[model samples]
Target: MEINILAFGIAKDIFGASKVTIQLSDAATIAELKASLEERYPKLKQLASYMVAVNNEYAESNLVITERDEVAIIPPVSGG
Candidate 1:
């Protein structure tokens, strides 16, 4: 299955792109996708507070990600 992932704000810096395409197996969950990304990009591993959105709506990490799903990653914000 092909999942379209978007990296927003600082996430793009860590991921080195605004958007990416990831090939995943069926029944893949957000957690699984996250793990795969972290394995590929060690810099992203420390970003545990990121928010996920599936097809433009907020989604949980445990939620299933389908081939038809468009995933977006919104990393945690920091401000003073």
Candidate 2:
């Protein structure tokens, strides 16, 4: 299956684009997606932490990703 991810902040810089496309096995979980992203973008692993949101909701590790789902890569945010 193919998924389109929306990146923000450092995530966009690491990916070199605001959006990235990735291939994954059918019924892949969020954890698997993270692993795939880490494999392709090593810099992501260096981040303090990140989260995957599906359909506007924070996804769990076990959350299954479907092609129809809207996926976003949310990097950490800091504010004074």
Candidate 3:
């Protein structure tokens, strides 16, 4: 299955881009995706603090993600 992954803030920096399309097994969960990404991009391992979103809202780690799902990595926020 294929999924569209969106990167935000530092997440983009870590990925060196704003978004990417990844191939994942059917019924893959958010946690599984994180693990796969970490293995592919070691830098992401350290950014584990990031939150995840499916479509337009936050998603749980256990939430199953599919090829048609829109995933986004939400990095920590900072404000003055």
Total clashing pairs for each candidate: 0, 0, 0
Candidate 2 lDDT over residue span 6-49, tens digit each: 99999999999999999999999999999999999999999999
Candidate 3 residues lying further than 4 Å off, grouped into runs, are none
Candidate 2 residue pairs in backbone clash: none
lDDT of 2 at 80: 75
TM-score of each: 0.84, 0.96, 0.88
- Each prediction's RMSD over C-alphas, in Å, is 2.1, 1.0, 1.5
The CA lDDT at 80 in model 3 is 80
The better-scoring model by TM-score among 2 and 3 is 2
TM-score of candidate 1 versus the correct structure, residues matched by position: 0.84
Model 1, range 5-78, lDDT digits (tens) per residue? 88988789987889988878889988899888877777776776787899888888889988777789878867
Number of the top candidate by TM-score? 2
lDDT of 3 by residue, 1-80 (tens): 88888998888988888998777899999998888888777887676477889988888889998877778988876768
Evaluated at residue 37, the lDDT of candidate 2 is 97
Q: Worst 10-residue stretch by lDDT in candidate 3?
A: 39-48
Those runs of model 1 whose alpha carbons end farther than 4 Å from true positions after fitting are 78-80
Worst 10 residues of 2 by lDDT: 71-80
Give per-residue lDDT, candidate 1, residue 44: 78
